[model samples]
Target: MACRCSPLLLPLLGWSALLLAPMLLVQFANAAIFVDDRGVQHTWDESTKARVAVRAGIGAVSLYHMGMREEQLAATWGLWGVRGSDFDPENPSQGSIYPEADPSPEEAAFLASAVNLSPSCWKNPRGCFQWDDTAEVLGMRDEIDFIVNIDNGSAEDSYNAAEEAGMNVIFIDTFYEYNENCRASNYSIIDTSFCYGRSMIDVAQRIEELAVFLGVEVDQNSLNQQKQAACDAAQAFTETMKDLHDKGIRVKVSIVDTELRDDTGVTTASVADFDPIELWVPRTLEELGMPLLHAASYENNEYGYIYSDEYFPDCTPGFVNDTCNGNTYFPVDFWLIDSRSFILIDDNFKLIFPDRAMLAGQYWSYPRNDGSISYVMIESLLNEYRTRLGSAVKLQDSTGTCTPADPKATAHLVADGTGGLGLNEFICYDEAAIQQEYLQCPTVAPVPPVSTPTSPTPPTANPPVPTSPNTSASSDAIMVSTITSIAAAAVTAFLMFCSTSG
Candidate 1:
């Protein structure tokens, strides 16, 4: 796909003190807390909350590459202000930005103020950078922290580039692409990959980070408590999986998303010997057997950004790494052991999160569509399991039998065939569509055996010889008759000549 970044050509400025380190902050009050220049505790405000809500991640990547837009940022802040009560990421058919949508003027003003931290990044035409390896484009920025180093195409090159840039570089190859030189974190680093496993928690921390950097301590006890709660949710989810297995209902993880893997430059997976920061998740179904879904690639080194790889078959190339906007990308290297897609079966024991369009990140893709994110809080995902216990009817096959072509078929869900969510919109997961996807046909009927031909008669070679003898006699008789006729004709010709002369 075509990705562009800030390409302004300017002289490099000396590096500034490393921007706020996330570790300097601690948790408090079960909420986000960060330390500021003044050493005071700070919490996320409405505007900060809004910005962090829609962001899959917050960092140098989006700022440098990925073409992050001001309007989308503003919309995210607006949407964040109305999560849950005012908005539902799970159900998009309802709500607006205000009473639903249209954030209040004061809220709008705050979002605007909060969002313009790097007006220079947007205002300067020179800072726009587009990376298409072979593209003959030369551009630079003035006074940046990181210096980029070049290697033909290796992970070491990325590290070397980061080292040369004089800035701390966290390789997020799973989520976003760093500058080829690996120098700066402008727009490209501003991805929301971090929001995948940890939703509200990331929101709180990201907001606090922004508030502190813009001018700010975020709560230590609160955030600590939240993390603990998140861990609890993870534990609860695993237990629920055990219960489901008892009921013969199972969760088969289809595909692990791209951001859920390690950097292409590093190894695909971690080993006892090394810690690899790729793969967006922790302990996948393949590595650890939880009710968690596992992933298989559409092709070697390629995967669907969508909920399942099956959708990859349906996808046509667009942007987002030449993939269909199923939100699939390179598996992110970092993943939480506990984080998962909330799409699951209801206690009724039927499918819940079945379709890619209804899955998380539907609106938030790399090419960056106008879709908004729903706050699938840790609690909501946990609730999905709790809500599904003994709830749904025994799922039936497409033929209406409990034993579908696939024994795993619990039920069937059909798509409304609406195809996709509207522009800048996302429709919730369609259970019917998901159910329909599982129903399969049993074995095909066997064809009748082919009849064998009887062996050819031994030529009745004698019969063939008898027919040849007759043929030889007929030919001799014909030749003799022809000679006799010729002789008779000559005699008649002489008589005729004599008659004519007389």
Candidate 2:
């Protein structure tokens, strides 16, 4: 049927069509139909794809989602950045992860670019797992183009709602089963192999798949190369550690979370309660031919819970009673007497264990479970072992105190400083003391700040000193571009609407 417009409105309609043409063309170009890994077909609009929300059961998965993104803006769910008491004890939500409550320029730029969902989630009843109001409270249901759901159990309803709302849902691992490497062990925590190995590989593959779904071209070769390089490095580190063990140089180490202690000592709370030795620490150490000190000495199957007089023969009756009741401090002194070195997860142990054991290093200065696992973490652990084994010296005489104040101890503590115990703890290698050509003990370079990422990108073999970019200018440019686009669209729509009306 032919429809006729008023003679006066004909010119207006023509102008309106002309104005809408460019925007319509842009929208049409961005629209696509593709199938996700789940085999479900989806139609995507470019406007919707610009914003993404990740709802993964595990923190690692959420981090992988963001790290894999080339340019898409992600809604950050978990905490990222430094350790220390940045938050108020009474009000947990009013905290910043940055040191001195200020983000470094680089961090500020990154945070500005991403959407932080953490604050909103913190106020919610169920936190990040809340599904019913997730879309509304996160401000994501209408704002986001896609919801990356990893079958975290609580998000099924949210995922369904999103799909119904015409939002593209990228569902990965519907059943959400851990890989065999993680599940094979009866450890309290997921195996480190799964953390750095299988999980990363899966994420990498899914990232490539996501790119295809979005019609975005990624450098597959470059990603593959990075993956291979990381794997090779891990393998080499393991092999080197094993070789060191074959040489009869046993490096006994323990992983402890000192933050769990109240006045008593390693309390049975949160991460402190579990024995990391039972997980990857001992397994990896054993594989590397290093002796597991705690496992070897303590006969009890449960390492954290020190029950029965058989484990603590020297304790008084009151001490024994407290030990059996799980109120006693972790037997740090007993463990460290034989074991010369240990790795701490928290900074609280500086005073307690300093006189007992030499601090080898600290791990996850920024929370470990919050998606901090990476190939670089594995490399860092191996490096710590290498440094400790090569540089360890006996500063304590029969009296068990640092007499004569070893210069090397001060130098090592200062160099590797991650809130390390004061200089009086243990002796380490100086330039003259280090016999190994590869060992770079007592380094003169300033130690990295405590706020450094847990799994920072490993420096190149001969790394050049890095220079910071003009992040402020870069951020300004992005803002300007976004504003310009919005203004242009707004003006164009208004002009077209005014011209079309009769």
Best by TM-score: 2
CA lDDT of 234 in candidate 2?
A: 42
For 63-178, candidate 2 gives per-residue lDDT tens digits of 33224442454654433432232432224345444232223333334433555555644323222443335556345655566666543233456556656766667654422124
- The local lDDT score (0 to 100) that residue 24 gets in candidate 1 is 22
Predicted structure with the largest lDDT when compared to the true one? 2
Error of 1 at 99 (Å): 15
Model 1, C-alpha of 192: deviation from truth (Å): 22
lDDT of 2: 0.38
**Model 2 misplacement above 4 A:** 1-50, 55-71, 82-108, 120-139, 150-168, 171-199, 215-217, 221-225, 247-314, 317-367, 372-502
**C-alpha TM-score for every candidate:** 0.29, 0.42
lDDT of 1 by residue, 413-489 (tens): 00111111111121122223221111221233345689998898665544534434577556556655555555556
lDDT of each: 0.27, 0.38
The predictions' CA RMSDs to the true structure, in order, are: 34.9, 17.3
